[model samples]
Target: MFNDGAFAQITKRDKRDAMLINLVHGEPIRFGVDNERGVAMDSSGRIELVDVVDVGVENLLVHDETADDPSVAFAISRLATAPTMPTPVGVFRAVERTEYAAAVSDQVDAVTASQGAGTLEGLFASRPTWTVS
Candidate 1:
């Protein structure tokens, strides 16, 4: 029981909202106001927006050393013979990017120990170089 114009308007709103979401990572400013009383400079010599309150955390990185493991446990599901329903065969734990990087570094070290230095560099298709005139 929906009209064409209403559907088009909703679609346009959704598209605009999605585009805005992609542009802004966190919260978006809904409104802003400048006090006409007087202009004051901050410590950094910049005019501060006193009316607007801080929305989210300023520091994006979690620096806590004692933070719990962020890795997640997931199961591999497959369709078995008898029943059509999927069955969980194995459970695997995901590792963080740092863990992967460390593993790669260890592998590189092992390769260097047996193959000697600069072997990995030679394996690459192109080597970066800068010439100063």
Candidate 2:
């Protein structure tokens, strides 16, 4: 478990450093620390307590209603189906990294084909911008 202040600081730094990405049709999304702890951060930089055990990757799914648009449905769907587990930090990070890898894979085919090489660097370059706790 993370100390409250430590967790808050980590999440805040992550949120602050997150690279905002435009979803197809919803509000821009940024990668950051999320846990059973209610999305990890409040607008005021406070960490909200939550039932971590219940917060699975599925809960991070952004629905049309929550997203307020249809354009992002596909992306949200992809995110919804991403891997998730019941552990504290490692589980979420693994799921997120998996999702990030998949996202990068979508763009890697061309790079690998053109370069005639598939490397970790090439693959990582295609992943979503994110930070780990």
Candidate 3:
């Protein structure tokens, strides 16, 4: 149950059916004009789809009932950052793998000893010059 002021603030000047529906259902639903643009979350916890034109319909993935603590805020932030559609799942996975590979390469380079200029060129050029001087 939200305060009348809060409810009025959400409903006032917004005649969207989606917003009204969300408000009546007591569930938080987010809307955005486009996927690339900013999203607006209905914090009133009601489902009323009054004006669904400007606000695009997006499915509710997760909800937070106890949002009074810092940890809950962090969890919500993580959820929001997660991929909404599965179309980019493969690309996202590949990017994660590439990032891991780069991190491992950097670590290996840090641990490996630096070779002399001659040895560096030989190693880089894939030429094997085995002479211990």
Candidate 4:
């Protein structure tokens, strides 16, 4: 019930303020907002995170073959997968530019090591706002 022609047309849309994204990371991937799944920028300049979207079929990547080299494969893979999503949805960091989960975990490990006690764990665990929702 989907149109290949219409799907390919996904690339033609505007790409201003495009955020660099990667679920399949090699280099920072440029993703124009096809449509925002849910996250919206608030007046405070803090982006609101609604849900986590992992790197998978459900979080589809929009790419253009004629426009980009690496983009085509990711786009096609997204098209082939079932239950793929449009828009780069999730809590994204402007720095790491990788998948949100990877950025948080990987960067944490890269910065310092986690020891037994009297460590950063206390700082993180003690914070009231740190509890999982």
Candidate 5:
């Protein structure tokens, strides 16, 4: 659980209902909006029907339940910054990191802020990325 209204995940199983999942530490510790069905705007002066919105990997965050020590935090951070990932879409790497240090609430504002634009980009994070390989 991130203070950014982003949910934490130790495994891919935790992302069953996530939307617009952003990379916090990597892909394990995901922070995204909860899934919803509806219409939305496209940032411009246009209305766009939406089902999902994707996020940049710059916010990658890998989850670590036992990250109670400096070594663990370092290790997890290393994983997030790792050069290569065995992804289904082929190899991938976290390009950059988004600095997120703030308070969150029970409302969707935290989740919306995580998307940077407050749009329905969170639902776009719901796409299943990794798989057991």
Candidate 6:
């Protein structure tokens, strides 16, 4: 929890119930707020809403306990030393196809090739001249 407030101010109604929730903590945190200050309960229970002007919270509130690691500090400490994912590299390769029709024969043969044999080296004894990157 932050030093200034155990709860972050969500909404405030003048002389009425102020809606507030607990900050992240290792304990099971429940919150109750007085117009003057905020209060926290470590044991699991419903959130307490006391009216600064009225009696209780007007809005329906539900609380759920998650299965996440209770220690936020420990989780952050582990993340600090975790390895980052590797950057992705781009790949480019040329397409080659046989011409089925007579008209496109010249165009198919003209499909350009470049210098180096990449993965195609086994198929072509000569330098595989299809452009690849």
Indicate the worst ten consecutive residues by lDDT in candidate 3. 86-95
Tell me how many clashing residue pairs each candidate has: 0, 1, 27, 0, 21, 0
- Expressed as tens digits, the lDDT of each residue in 11-128 for candidate 5 is 3455433322232332433332443322223355232223334432332233333344344343333332322321112122433333453233334476656755433576567667
Candidate 2 lDDT score relative to the true structure: 0.37
Error of 6 at 49 (Å): 11
TM-score each candidate.
0.20, 0.18, 0.20, 0.18, 0.16, 0.19
Compared with the true structure, model 1 gives a TM-score of: 0.20
By lDDT, is 3 or 5 better? 3
lDDT of 4 by residue, 1-133 (tens): 8766544433433432233233233322334354232332335533332322443324333322234344344333343233233334322222324688988988677666654335676887775665477
Model 2: per-residue lDDT, tens digit, 1-133?
8656643422454543232222322212223344223222335543232344555443333222333334333323333232231112211111123577787896787776878776688878986779898
Clashes of 6: 0
lDDT of 3 by residue, 22-105 (tens): 211223334332222222445664322223345544534233433343443343333323223111010111112357789998
Q: Which numbered prediction scores highest in lDDT against the true structure?
A: 4
Error of 2 at 7 (Å): 24
Off by over 4 Å in 3: 1-39, 44-50, 53-98, 113-133
lDDT per prediction? 0.32, 0.37, 0.36, 0.39, 0.35, 0.32
Model 5: how far residue 83 lies from native, Å: 37
Model 1 lDDT tens row, 11-123: 46543222111111122212111211111234654322222333233311212223244221111111112232222222222334568789999999999899788745575
lDDT score, candidate 6, position 59:
32
